[model samples]
Target: MRKIIFLSLILIGLGVLLSFRPDRKPLSFPSSRVLPASKKDLQYKTHSVKQSVVHTLLIPASSRFLVTPTLSPELSSLESFVQKHQAIAAINGGFFDPENRKSTSYVMLQGVWVADPKDNKRLMNNLKLRPYLKKILNRTEFRRYRCGQTVRYDITLHSEPSPTGCQLLDALGGGPRVLPELTSVQEGFVDFAKGKVIRDPLGSSQPNARSAIGITSDGSLLVVMVAQKPEAPSNSGLSLPALADFMKTQGVEKAMNLDGGSSSCFYYKGKTVYGKINQQGNQVRRELFSVLVIR
Candidate 1:
């Protein structure tokens, strides 16, 4: 009888401990829907992981991709871009300065350099940023190459040359490759020394809304957005390392993190989901300077 009582107490204690554990409960996604396209050529899914609702969209290699600019007088929202371009799907892309409305990330469209960091005087003239200008200018980017009839996608540094016979078509720059390796420090997302972070522009260790693009081994394109859980806004979202791990598990061969936080958003089939959530558990929406769209 005593043994039975002790076992019951132990079980109760264990249950209590688990109840207070982070990410112990799985949340259901009522907004998630599976859209059909070419059987499995295009897919979208919302997965509940820890404190985030991860949204993923996969586009087959046969589809065409474009790095679209706002093109208007100012930055535009993902929804506007989707509606204007009649895109099948869209994800926020690249970093930019909101104050001056200038892009800090490189963007190429149809073999034309649409956005260049050199044009952003605020970034280029900042004395504080001078030391890291080289890394900032050569951040990782998603590139599309056309070699005759064969088209391929790659995640490489901005300075990387296109494959021998291939013509560079479209490119969108983002920071710090996530898969294969985390280039947070080398890409200037963070400054680390002696195992301690001295400067972190993206809060590399904290949970925050994040967007990333990846290329699977089969050449399929993946656009992922990690949204903060509404029920646990402060404790939600994934860090850089966690994002990289998640992308790897999703079969990503190469990946790069895009401009995230309030700038993170995903749109498909007229439905849109923003990533960042405020302390009040409300989603924050912001205009984007560039986007990767499938039209």
Candidate 2:
């Protein structure tokens, strides 16, 4: 009888001990050969264009790019955007009205329209007149097609209307195509396209901190941010044409310029990788409306 009672107490004590133990996350074992850390694969380099400085980042093909929209209407800095999304790297995305701090271009998050046109008239007026845009804009069937699972890095430029342009915005839902810049490759480089290197028409000589996105020959996405050093002279950023030339050297077949100048920002691994100095003699870290985050 004593033995039976002792065994029951022992069993109850064991059960109580097991219940008090803390939960643990499953351990991940490396398969066969251990792989190198992902951070080791990311290449960081600095290049000089005359007096200006260019900071380039080469991300491997395995990485994924996502467009993170503002959860609130208020503008937030690049650091806040990265933390909110838990991104490995990020750059400012598409244009936004400074007053309202909302994306001026169409933005879709996870197959849902975060920003869309209200009335048909507004939708029709926002339609891009270029041939490529007209086809998708005029067709009612293609208006609501899902272009991709996430937002594309490229923007549909209402500034320079072209028939052969990104239909991503329309695919999400009808919205304005008014962006200052579009795919730079499609815009064409007179010097580079002609197998020569001359200053581009878009003021390649005027140096300013720049931000751009591109696709490599092997289909890897490239996000670039160029900024002037805080202590460097005022003449310390890449010209648009110089930026294009640099992109060509990087094997980028297609590319686009994002908001540059004071808006240029690059965040990587929980830190601001690159940022420009503003005219106010302060390092610029302006609040962003949207950002392209890497996961």
Candidate 3:
């Protein structure tokens, strides 16, 4: 009888301990691998594209990351967003509507659905209208879905006819995903799988300030941006083709362009890292509703 009573007490104690455990598990990062190239290969160059300055950051594969969304319905500047979340680094996320302050793409923050698929229909329609995008769009959909659990971080790239936001959310297991566009890589790379790099319908002549996220072959995450002087020519930034080429050189196996133009912004270690020039001839730090951050 004594043994039976002791066993019951032990089981009750175990239950109490389990009930008190935290809901979220601690994060575990992947092992680091040596980069194929030197740091100089990843370094940003000023005047690399005539008056524009390109800035790049290589995040180690083992770093903890998150896609933070604005708590309020209104948009927030990079500074405000970083300060509010106490983030170590950040960059503007997917497109958003300026008037209604609604996200232009699907977004999930901390397991909560912040924007719906309807908001992104306009972008999809615009792509459908583009002649060059027709073939690629039909063959490949451009979508970035990043999901994280306490033990691992998974980033999935989907082509056209991608899954619904709810389906993606369910797959994420209640993680965050900031869908800007689909995979930039469609085909023709030895290291990358086939159907990765989509042929650029828009020629490589035009350039503008741009922001992109890429995953290197070694699995490191890269947040790359090009900053241009307000007075620079309209074609002063790297075109889509050039951007893709650059990412490939930096060892990116998969990549996606985030919002650019005046919406480009990057912050690191409590400081504004890089961005495009605004109409006021100042570095653009436009308010954003979604941001990929490191805490």
> Could you say which candidate leads in lDDT?
1
TM-score of every model versus the real structure: 0.84, 0.58, 0.59
- What is the C-alpha local distance difference test score of each model? 0.86, 0.56, 0.56
Clashing pairs in 1: none
- Candidate 1 per-residue lDDT, tens place, 174-208, comes to 98888889988888458769998889998888899
Model 3: per-residue Cα lDDT over 187-275, one tens digit each: 11112247553343222235777777766666666777777766764546776667767767777776666677777788776568545
Candidate closer to the true structure by lDDT (higher is better), 1 or 3: 1
Model 3 worst lDDT run, 10 consecutive residues: 170-179
Residues forming the 10-long window of minimal summed lDDT in candidate 1: 64-73
- What does candidate 2's lDDT look like per residue over 1-295, in tens digits? 9999999999999987877667944557878457655742665666766655666777655554443343335878888877877887788765555655655444556545565322224334554423233432321111212234432333333333323433334322111121223323333222354775553433344677778776666655566787776666377777766777777888776666666666788877666855567666567767776676766
What TM-score does candidate 3 reach? 0.59
How many pairs of residues collide in each model?
0, 3, 16
Would you list the clashing residue pairs of candidate 2? Answer: 131-163, 132-163, 204-241
Indicate whether candidate 1 or candidate 3 has the larger TM-score. Answer: 1
- What is the descending lDDT order? 1, 2, 3
